[model samples]
Target: MNTVIVQPTGITPADVLAVSRGGARVEISDAAMEAMRTSRALVDDIERAGRPVYGVSTGFGALANTSIAPERRAELQHALIRSHAAGIGAPMPAEVVRAMILLRVRSLALGRSGVRPDVARALVDLLNAGITPWVPEHGSLGASGDLAPLAHCALVAMGEGWVLGKDGARVGAAEALHAAGLRPIELAAKEGLALINGTDGMLGMLLLALNDLCHLLTMADLTAALAIEAMLGTDRPFQPELHAIRPHPGQGVSAANIHRLLQDSQIMDSHRNDLVHAVQDAYSMRCAPQVAGAARDTVAFATEVAARELVSIVDNPVVLPDGRVESTGNFHGAPLGFACDFLAIAAAEVGAISERRVDRLLDVCRSRDLPPFLTPDAGVNSGLMIAQYTAAGIVAENRRLASPASVDSLPTSGMQEDHVSMGWAAARKLRTVLDNLTSLLAVELLASVRGLQLRAPLTPSPAGRVAVSMVEPFAGAPGPDVFLAPVLEKTRGLVAGPDLRAAVEAEVGPLR
Candidate 1:
């Protein structure tokens, strides 16, 4: 009988992830309920007063000034859902759809959207009952607030669109609603526009990508720690005083995390014998914290922007308590659009440095006495030679995707809706960058574990040993190089899962 309630003020990136992962039940607050009531009352008063209102008593887009007859109001609302539900692309992954539903619910529960309480309750009911609508992944220009993608979702409330059932099969939305003992919510004043016009599509993707990036940054820190140990690099660059002077939050956090991970490593100490034989290590080994820290800082900035966007209502022709229907640009996606692009660049940088470590690990001359390509018989067995090639390719692709999506804008809706934000493109690229970084870090993990094996009997630090143990079970030592593709895939899975991340954090403190 334990329930976790999320108020507008209390929701975080972690909370979004928990709800998307089906880890908790969600409810709107009583205060939120009252706010929704007040808002809806104002909308009714406006309609009763016989005033012009956008999207309520009138048509949408280029037809915004065109008024509808009183008798056809219901028809107008229904047509909004049908015509705007023109999303044309592959189906969005179930997780992203769930996130969109949850985000839309949270925004409405803030009580500024003028939607009826029944509409809010229906969204919350869908989240609790796990009836996610089948939303297409594309067709949003990110202005007019992701209309197409969200309309496809809003169709479910009208007892239309596809629904994913508990058994993993698609069914009619009406059937799912009936099975859950619910009915199609009647569209009240401004309800249709409130349901479909918001930045939920881009916001949902950003929420998911941000949550993953937070964890991936921690994983990157751990991977960099292992790479540092393997390369026998100096830790003085991460000294607290050095980072304190400049004091970028992410840099300080990364430096501190790396220092703690390498705290007890004897191998990290200045070695006279190794120093005489070797000069300085490569930039990948030496500047791990600085590069990784910048990416972490960018993510922190984006998280702040996204968190604010989530709680605030982004609907248009918003109803005020004073009975004024004010049309504003709050629905613009520029803020979220820019934040997602910035995060994409940040995540791509993490992949860039991790790929360098993979390269260094493969080069026999650079690797300081490890066998060529980490294969004892370099000529016969290719070992991890091709693995670096894969990592390099991924990193190169990440660079291309890192270009800012917000910088590009196009006119839409016959020049009436000019200057689109392209927020969806930014969110999409951020997700891609995250996937590439995961594979890149996995390659680094594999190479570091192999490097440690080659330098065996020379024990790694406690934290490194824990990281190695988490991945080692999934990937055993490569002997004579049979197919390594599976090993690499397993390593990627190990690093990406929450369990292995938890294990690493247990050994080394939180990599915040």
Candidate 2:
């Protein structure tokens, strides 16, 4: 019911997240509308004065030099939309389509794309009415601004594509718009190009991934702390002063968060002066701050990159207010693509370490007296041995999926779109990695919770206790011969819940 107005300079990840989560509405400012109007007027003047514009007066891609007659320009725009709607593969989920709509509207709202105000309004109306266009998951080379996928989005505005309605009904875009009392947007001059040419689709995936990764990173911290407590590992590895000397922002933040999570913990200090003679734990347990911190740093960088792109007008052949049209390459997705790959690598490592921790929890020798698979009847039940296998499978899958997509490219549009970034592939793979990592964390959480329960009356660190209490309601205490899949799924829901992160933060305070 609340609306958040985003000015050109005031967009934040929190604002975007709020909008994406359906808690807030997005509205553009009057200055932004004025800019769009000025740009549109320039486009009209150019078309009337018979000037040669790359996308306005000519065909797109390899046919950029071919001129369109004045009378058929509108037809040209319409044809562009209809012909380019060639998206393939499974349809993108509704949340992603909603994010794409929000991001694209924000970009055009910056007013440099030469799109008509009505076109921008149509996109906003669709968002307000919950009309999500059926955008497919494939068919983008990632060089020309996610062309095919975005065209599918533009088709809905023209009343030709499919839309998912409020009550979960599938209907034609025209009927959906008519039902909502909205009219189809008309393309004027550069409006078609503006609508279809941008990094919004790829960026939408990245934004959603970033939101999930933020939660995952915090979950990783909590899981790592639980694993450390289970292993009775020394807390010296996360000492704040030790991290301050090296001074990597992410490492320091990670160390502080882990230390906070383990602070005032009778369990963590229980093994501090014990006769336990182990020199040090494995890298997965001892170097958790370093590994998790690196991922956190990458996420920080990727967040900045995505935020910078949110307000950028990325369409080509931009129309200036002085009636000048200049051809450019703002449609390239390389920047966001590189960030997406980086995020995948980072998130993949989180899964890798989590799988290792799951292994540690399963091994009786490493789990500090916890029963094998934390089950009393391990021989008959086989306990959580298979859960570790599932975690390892997902971790290996993440490694394959995290292979940098930006490194591969293929020519399209007869070499006019040569040297593509494959950004959509990178974004898609990042989402996959996020899912895989979430599952991995869920397994780790289930194992850690089981291990913590074995240490029952030995109260965990204050932070770990809070985390355990949060998931305990959903997962319950693991018993012998129980089906682990339901428990794992419930653990995942807890990890994905908004309150989990808030609970962890409340217990541990700001993560430095």
Candidate 3:
């Protein structure tokens, strides 16, 4: 993997994933280095002025009114890091920690936060060295920008906390730093506040979720398309003319994708003019684009929010270009919190609708003339019966997880930091919902492909045939349910990626 260069310009979602999940190195640009130096001078000037500043000279949170002696200023930074590293629950994944560190590093490099260049450089080095910090799961209330999680992340870099070993055991931070041929740097002046006060954790999760959803949503479209043909339903609702009147960008795109995928289909032609099939399909088959499209638009909106956050200066008492240090509300995570919540609900809706199609495929009454549960021996095999149940189970779980975390809040930091964002929880729950949705879509794919195969001489669409090929080896022949868990798991592995979409797109041109 290539190194991700950090500079005054900006970073992208791709750069974040590269460093976080791909183990890529980071390099700070000279311009960013110069900017950091210039900002640090401004902080030095403030300290020499002997005036009280929020983070540089005084205490934090409810203690903001207290004045700190110059000698104790360094202790303030250390204390802030140590005290705030009070996160609980299981440790965060190494990738999540890497993303938090990278985003924090990017913020410091922008020259707004008054921190030494070495502070940012040290973080980049740690990222490159792959020495991930042991951040806990349940620390952030999402206010003050993931303070607890970021604190734990920064702690390992300061040689005072814990690191996750290769085998995921907790190791001494100092020992890890030494092993990596790196030394931990002490936080100076307002550096501690700058390091921990960011929306990096929630924003990082949102970005990763967005990338994953992009592929998964496309997969959703394909799976929905397969289900429509597998159940011998008409594709008229997917026609471009029908969607153009609505004018929603996502809806139009999804409609066109299904319309194109259903082209040159022998199965659709088999029922094209038959009075035998219902004039219209059920809501799940007819309105997949409507639900999935709304979800796509939601993702678009969240991406806009994440993009703006990428360039935001989210530190307290930031160094202004006009030479003044001022506290700010930019660190509030409401924007990111709202975006995460929106995506979570969208994931739930998509999964719920996909589960409907999965159930339809297994229902002998609704699945056209297909056998009950797609089984050769109905009552004897109970074939794929619980598979629909699994999809239903996930859809129900997602409904619970879809409840917005950002909507809830509690007072903290002596009530000075009240009205928290809870964005971290929102983002965390979004991840789980998306995971469940990936499985839900996989179940749909498994059932639909089996439904199409059960049709025998009645061929499917060209794209649907390609989709069957993608899952056939893993799906096996539509038969008795012989240990179905591995099959669903294998199909989910494909459903969670771009391979299925790519394969179909290769033959059918492209899906939206």
Name the candidate, 1 or 2, with the larger TM-score value: 2
Candidate 2 vs candidate 3, TM-score winner: 3
lDDT of 1 by residue, 1-512 (tens): 22345564435666677777754677888777787888888887877877888977898888998998877877788889888998876677777777777777777777677878788788878878778887777788898888888888889988998877656667899999999888887786688888888888888889888888888888888888887777676666777998999888888888888878877776665352466433466788767778888988888788788888877778887877687877878778999999999888888888899988878877887777778888788898988899999998998899999999888889987788888898987887888889999999999989988876676767788877886776677667656877788888888887788876677777776667
Please give the TM-score that candidate 1 achieves against the real structure.
Answer: 0.95
Off by over 4 Å in 3: none
By summed lDDT, which 10 consecutive residues of candidate 2 come out lowest? Answer: 6-15
Candidate 3 local distance difference test against the native: 0.90
Instruction: Return the top candidate by TM-score.
Output: 3
TM-score of predicted structure 3? 0.98
User: What is the C-alpha lDDT profile of model 2 across 386-477, one tens digit per residue?
Assistant: 98989888988999998999999988888888899899999999999999898998888778877877787889877678767877776667
* Cα RMSD of predicted structure 2: 1.9
> On residues 170-237, what C-alpha lDDT tens digit does candidate 3 reach at each position?
99999999998999888899999888998999989999999999888888888999899999888888
The regions of model 1 sitting more than 4 angstroms off are 1-10, 165-169, 269-274, 277-279
Query: Could you estimate the TM-score for every candidate?
Result: 0.95, 0.95, 0.98
RMSD, candidate 1, Å: 2.1
Alpha-carbon local distance difference test for all models: 0.80, 0.82, 0.90
